[model samples]
Target: MEPSEHARLDAYWRKIASEFAPDPTARPSSLLVTHLLPERPAFVRAVGAVSELRAVLPKPKSVVAAARREVEQSYRVDELTRERFSDPDDAVAYLESRAAGERIILLDVGGYFAPTLNELCTRFSGTVLGVVEDTENGHKRYASGEKLPCPVISVARSPLKDPEDFLVGQSVVFSAEALVRGRGDILHGRSAYVLGFGKLGSSIARLLHAKGVHVTVYDKDPVRRAQAMAQGFGVARDRDQALSAAGLVLCATGSLSLRGEDFPTLRNSAYVATVTSSEDELELSGLPAGYSRSAVGEHITRYETTGHYFYLLNGGEAVNFLHGASVGPFIFLVQAEIIAAARTFTRAELSPGMHEVPAADRSTIAAHWLNYWNR
Candidate 1:
């Protein structure tokens, strides 16, 4: 990076560190796996304040050139891609090699390395101090696995994350609107379907409704469906029917909510977007044989199969990530919580299992956030 860019980033990092005030004595060696976007520098700086950052595993789709360069200059950079780590086993092998007998904590997003971290915890018990997961999908991944041997600290469900998720939902809509508008289309007054009524999904659905779009929501969980209905949004009883009728579909579910079978049911010219970070949320590989896919616009891909065609925004990854994955300084609240969780894990003897950030840590982080932003 240029001298000016370096100085600016340094100033920004200092600003964040002063506000978050990470514990200086809680420095655990850590391997960070997350999106490498411009906003990530502050997160890295905050974590580095209380953790010995050994390396970074950047999610391929979320990498921004400038951020990647800065991180590479400061720490080891390992790009997580199919070519680098063919499968979960390969990823595990690489992580083990990287650990090199060090007792390091794993900081992850989307649980991309959950299986690897789980195996490491067993193979080299205690050497893998613990894991700090940032997303709900990662939380679910660790939750679904067999009993974990080390604590898996999760900030996914923290009330502190609500502000970030809320803005994330807004960004999803904003990006979708920009893409649609680029094609001479407008989101206002359009019929939309939101697949998943989870925190992010509900936020997206509500934003779309507020913009005068007719929003229909579907979730496999009956409770979520009821919640959507209670919020006065249309509840989709028949998934395929809703897809066929809506002009836009936004997926926030961290699972394979849309696959080949559902693609053909989409309205011919409809646009699809996702708020989840991983491509597993859409499962484009499930698209039937003879399907043709091509980039139709910046961050938009056109997929055609069985006479049905639709656009996939941001290549089926989180649409908000196309622009920096930021919700402004509020995101640093969650980042601060992650640091606090890491500090707690290193200092306390918590038993192995899924763990939430302690209330005290969250309270402290929230207080700092309020003080910083309210000033």
Candidate 2:
């Protein structure tokens, strides 16, 4: 280990020395194997005593496959439900069967699943899993139970990047980037109006903020509205205010409450889009000339003459979840880490019930994601 790494580990070890001490008859602490292991494990001796302990990391391919399969399995309850499972009723039946009388650890990474999932959780007497999605809606659900039937599991932080590395040479980092590149629209100067401050909306705000775009947010919930302001976002108390000024309006509220009349004030030059809701369902027919809608892809195409707007990039799904491919791998990885550690600490099986996935697990997951980025 380099001197800095060694020093950092030394301080970490000192702080948690009691947790790593050997127990005469118990399994050795995984903390030792995980936290104390060298950044690059080698056959060299001076590394550390804990480095000698066997450590097992899950295969990234397997992890990705499992997640994809789960997404496929959860077609009904997930927002991607409409695209993947043509029949909503069938999907609901399957979800109900799986959730009946069980504890669920839902790692809601986006706000799409909550509405239906919340109903399912209440109906089946099973808990909804984690609410660690990156939107204000999820955060509000976690903070207040007014709209939720059961308690929230937890909320997630942003994905981690490797401290020492950046980017994969040729691979797409985010689905949005692919769409943006494909559409040839520069997002740098665009003003994005996000209509919601929930988990998913908050995440979108952060991304746009980081990209140097002016982001104005709107949410009726006072708490969420306050939270957005505290984060240095311009909070739009009224939806019209946000819509009239933005170059692009991204509907992130996960609510169908918005109506055609609500957006009549939008300027013809402004593009209308959403991370939630399908283009066909957006009721954009009455939109003025120079507006259009399209699916989420890497690039966006504008059809101003026809009043058509393409929502390209990430399948028009929650921007953050689709960004997970490169920019947010830690989103899932952190949830996995929390699941793993929760399992380890409680010796509990992964089941249904609203369970708190730890934030530390998320940090570790972020670290691993960053490591992958470097490699």
Candidate 3:
């Protein structure tokens, strides 16, 4: 980056740090793994302000290369550490090596460092402070683990995150629409199947409906389906039927909601996308024999089998990530919540288990967000 651009970015982060300052006493050394988008500098600075930032691990597969380079240059992250971020095992080992004497906290998104969580906690014991997870997928991963040795604080479901989640849903629809329009097709007035009627899914459904797309909502939970129905959305009583009918299918469940087995039932030429960062939302490996796939557009792929074809947006990864995964200024609320969560984890005596960001912390962050933005 040029001097002017660097100065501007530094000034932006400094303002964020001032506005969202956490407790000064809770500055534990931290290892962070999150999407390295341009907007993330503010988050990095916010977290760094309240912690001793040991390493910043950008998910190699998901990070925007230019943005990653900018952050690396701006932060002066060394080449050796940058090399380690490319491999998960190496990243974990690096963090393990850093946990010898000082208290080490982990701030992770999507549980990118989850595979080694157990070993890290087991080996480091008291040295490993805890983990602060940033997404629902990561929260589920840590929650499902067998009795972790340290607290796993989740800001994913915090009320402060609701706005971010809603904006994520909007971004999913926006990116999908942009891709479809690029292919000389229109999404308005078409049918769409939205899997997982969670906050994100529901927002996408409503946004699509507002855009004149006929949307059908499906969820594994009966209550969510009922809620969708109550909200006047067409609930998918038959998953395969819905899949076979819609021209667009969006998976937001953060799991393998769409598998290869279900691909055969999808409408030919249907546009499939996801809202989660990983490919865990769609399982394309189970595709039957004779299936063929090829890139059809930037971050779009065409898959053909059984005399039919469907397009996968962003390689079945989160569609929004292709566009920097930004939710604008509201994301700062959640970032501040993360900083607060990290501070709480280090200072408090929380037990070894899954925990939510305390309501008090959230309120404080929300107040700061309002004050900062309104100012």
Candidate 4:
């Protein structure tokens, strides 16, 4: 007997799901471990499900091999640099070749550098500058710490372009792309106020305005405020002017004050979300001091209390850390663009204050990722 249309559709959906679904029954992939420390070995394997977790222990050497593979495959040295580096020494040599005439600015913290590797990287970089320390709201990671032999600058308390000697790459560039080119209309035509006018906030405003959203931007800095006005944005002189007349409020300033009281002046129907950092927990407003809350996390909280739906992201964390990573191809495209910029600019001069990744490189990365995805 022929299956019904609904049955066929169900089967098709199930088949699609099976392709991407985590395989519980399949044996876990082998472990590769490498422990630089003699006493401790590094472990490598994607862990998921109970059975997968039970797989054998990792050996340090194997981890070393896996890390090398990650560096090579992810960096695509064969295509980008036209040569392959098999070992750490070779990789160091390759980086040296690239850095022979360039200045390298590294943000060191979070155990990102080991004492030995730190010495090695310093030696490898022709001109190495040290970051001061990671700060509460900015590129402190890139600047914070003991300054290296070369010129060191603090990203937290300085504009990037002031000391234009090196290039910055190797991170997400959502703000730049979203601002200059606009983005998918997640909140179009909504009365919106954006707090913060740095890279992320500026990008959000640019995209929101393109979608016809009336954007009132509030930044404490007069210079940034003027820049917003120059871009045809409604510049709010203070929080009152910003929060007073809006249905949606977006915090991209990396401000941690997205609590309910911050927007006390907002209309009762106004909703709030963030694109800077991911919020871990969400709480509803307008109820008793303590009300039932949603157990949602990882940014993307939708609340329906007063007959209107309000959304909050990661409690209000960086949007990219939540929804952005899920769109792997989108990120790959961005990274590829950055990589191309790294390749091109390795041959040129770089200006400061977080330079925008070049457009041609962005195009190349986007095209490569798109083609790869289609394939």
Candidate 5:
């Protein structure tokens, strides 16, 4: 870590040591059903240590073959499950069958299985206290104008956007560089359109502009659009026109912002990718796509549309994540946020609506993360 990063972390960890030292044995005994990527085994073990982890339902989209192996080798969680399954539905069913009289708690990522979430709340009823989802896209399902059956806690909108900016911004730029590594200068003089002007989008735009690429940013929220304009980025006054003229279209919105209807508005050569959706089902499944594996070998799948050819890099997964760079070293802090959010979700006296992670918990985690980051 840099000297500044070390100093920042030292302050946080010092507070953590003074305030909240961990105790593995004092965890509450509760049934845990999780659906997430397998990249973070430390996350699995941490949550398991705090609960009776019954099953680890690894979502296939994010949990690549190597991730499955990592789960096996690194997840030494003895307090919960020992089996792994490909199907999230089976995991849900198993949890349902065992839900006759149990206190169930869900630890989810990307909220890939909304049907599963609905099922758990339906089958378990009052027994399931709440669920914690770490992705904005997943939280959107519950936060939408639909009736929810159980309590939900979302860690996606955590106030700690600075660290997230560090993780996601660097990851996207790194991946983009990787994509153009052997291709001989594809990024320099190209126009790129980024959807959403939030932390990730803004950072990506700044980085691409620094590379002399023409960058335009679009956002649904007026405040966000204004923010983009203030940052001196091209604010897309006309979405269709901006998208169609771009050399690249990066979806950082984390919502279902891009769809089949929207694809007609993009250039045939535009390299498209999404950032926040953790599953094919949540974000990519709805796109009107007809793609096949590219013989060109970069995992660049080719799609035929608009009487021309467009491409979906990494099979419509997050571009940054496609090259094995999703949540990097800063995940320790993110997991800390999730841990605090999950614990707060259970005990906080909030209503049945969406809520941020408690301020106190956020402060505590930030402090702890500072300590960890310094080291």
Candidate 6:
């Protein structure tokens, strides 16, 4: 079925159809995705799913492989015409080689590194219009003064709806539940330390607190710390204070907040997980040398840190997207936000600066989501 026809039944699809305006300055036939998206099927199928989730994207196998190949086998990769890159530099090099009139839509999760984005903004400027950023790390860069080419959109924390609050709530329930699955009442009376009192951290702290765990929130920002304290969640007085006797340490801050120096204080059997969009949120570099490591199956990694066992789900990537299968559908809902944001770049006269999903478009996504879910 044509994309328009599918839009008839799905409000989300309809919104995508209406929000996506073709670029007036360039053609948009090609696409490139990358490591920024580790195992996200929603992004891999974003373009094609505008027709509906099940629609087979007529694009070649190369299109699906633009990022990770985990989802490629499940999608239609009928051709090998488009370029795919596991290395960010290779993708950058490809952009540098593009001639005028060869612009294609670029969907990336991590083009935020100054040097990488600089290459695209200068050497490969105008080679593409759709530079969709789907993570908090990427959003932070847009807030930076560096200018890239035209057409950029971010769905991580859009001003329009900013569903991070809702998404994080769901993520906590699922990720926390995963940590306790078949493991007895680990959270019933344990001390839970959550780094970053941002949307995700607050939610995790709230849920954990409700579960009878002592929730302590650690955020470098004073305002956020006050918010956590006001919410009845314990605020970490200091960095080391946050890890003191923490039975469960969860990192929600997108920064390298959890590191090796903090490990010595992480109590034995203290479970550590990252619930942020960026993997570096829990800096593995902080793990002390000579720590034993093993895979505990189901994408969980067990590490002996400071003479205690620490379980890092999905290699400290986003736990909700990995071991928390129950959290899957909700993240997909956030993907609707992503699709809406990307659609904005297609038509809006945007600049190199970071941008959010417009209010009108954000409302469309929320409405369509409610309609689709019958909520």
Highest-TM-score candidate: 1
Evaluate model 3: give its lDDT. 0.78
Which model, 5 or 6, shows the larger lDDT?
5
Spell out the clash pairs found in candidate 6: 60-79, 61-77, 260-286
Provide backbone clash counts, one per model. 0, 37, 0, 33, 5, 3
Looking at model 3, which ten-residue stretch has the lowest summed lDDT? 76-85
lDDT (Cα, 0-100) at 324 in candidate 5: 59
lDDT of model 1 at residue 49? 67
| lDDT, candidate 3, 1-375, per-residue tens | 467655654565565566445556655888777777776765676667767787777765566667677667545342332344345567556766665567888888877556666767665534777888988888877888788878988988888889999999998999999999988899986799999998889999999999999999999999999999999999988988888999999998866788778988888899999897445687777777887889887777898866899898988778887676778768877777777777777567999999887787677667655755565
List the lowest-lDDT window of 10 residues for candidate 1.
81-90
- Model 2, residue 279: C-alpha shift (Å): 8.9
Ranking by lDDT: 1, 3, 5, 6, 2, 4
Colliding residue pairs in candidate 1: none
What ordering of candidates by TM-score runs from best to worst? 1, 3, 5, 6, 2, 4
Say which prediction, candidate 1 or candidate 3, comes out ahead on TM-score.
Answer: 1
In order, the Cα lDDT scores of the candidates are 0.79, 0.44, 0.78, 0.40, 0.62, 0.58
Taking the tens digit of each residue's C-alpha lDDT, what string does model 4 give over 1-375?
Answer: 135633433333333223223334422221111121111111111111111221122221112343445433322222211122224465456546544534443332111222223443455655433222222243432233354333222223223221111111111224222322232334554687877776656766766676677889888789999999999898876677567677777765543535554444556546565543332112234223432335343334545444344445445444343222233223233222222322333334443323344455445444443444555
Location of the lowest summed lDDT over 10 successive residues in candidate 2: 29-38
- Candidate 5 per-residue C-alpha lDDT over 184-206 given as tens digits, one digit per residue, 9 for 90 to 100: 54776668888877777787888
**Least accurate 10 contiguous residues by lDDT in model 5:** 76-85
Better by TM-score, candidate 5 or 4: 5
245 in model 2: Cα distance from truth in Å? 2.0
Assess the local accuracy of residue 65 in candidate 2 as a C-alpha lDDT between 0 and 100: 44
Better of 1 and 4 by lDDT: 1
Q: Write the per-residue lDDT of candidate 1 for residues 1-375, one digit (tens) a residue.
A: 467656654564465455444346545678888787776865776667666787888887878899888777777887675444335456656666676666688888877666555566655523778888989888888888788878889999899899999999999898899889887889986799999899999999989988999999999999999988899999988988888998999988877778868887788889988887546688677777777888887878898877778888888888887666578778777887777777777678889899988798788777766765665
* TM accuracy, model 2: 0.48
Against the true structure, candidate 5 has what lDDT? 0.62
Q: Write down the TM-score of every candidate.
A: 0.90, 0.48, 0.88, 0.42, 0.79, 0.74
Candidate 4 segments whose C-alpha is farther than 4 A from its true place:
1-129, 132-136, 140-186, 257-260, 278-288, 295-299, 302-310, 325-375
Query: Poorest 10 consecutive residues of model 4 by lDDT?
Result: 162-171
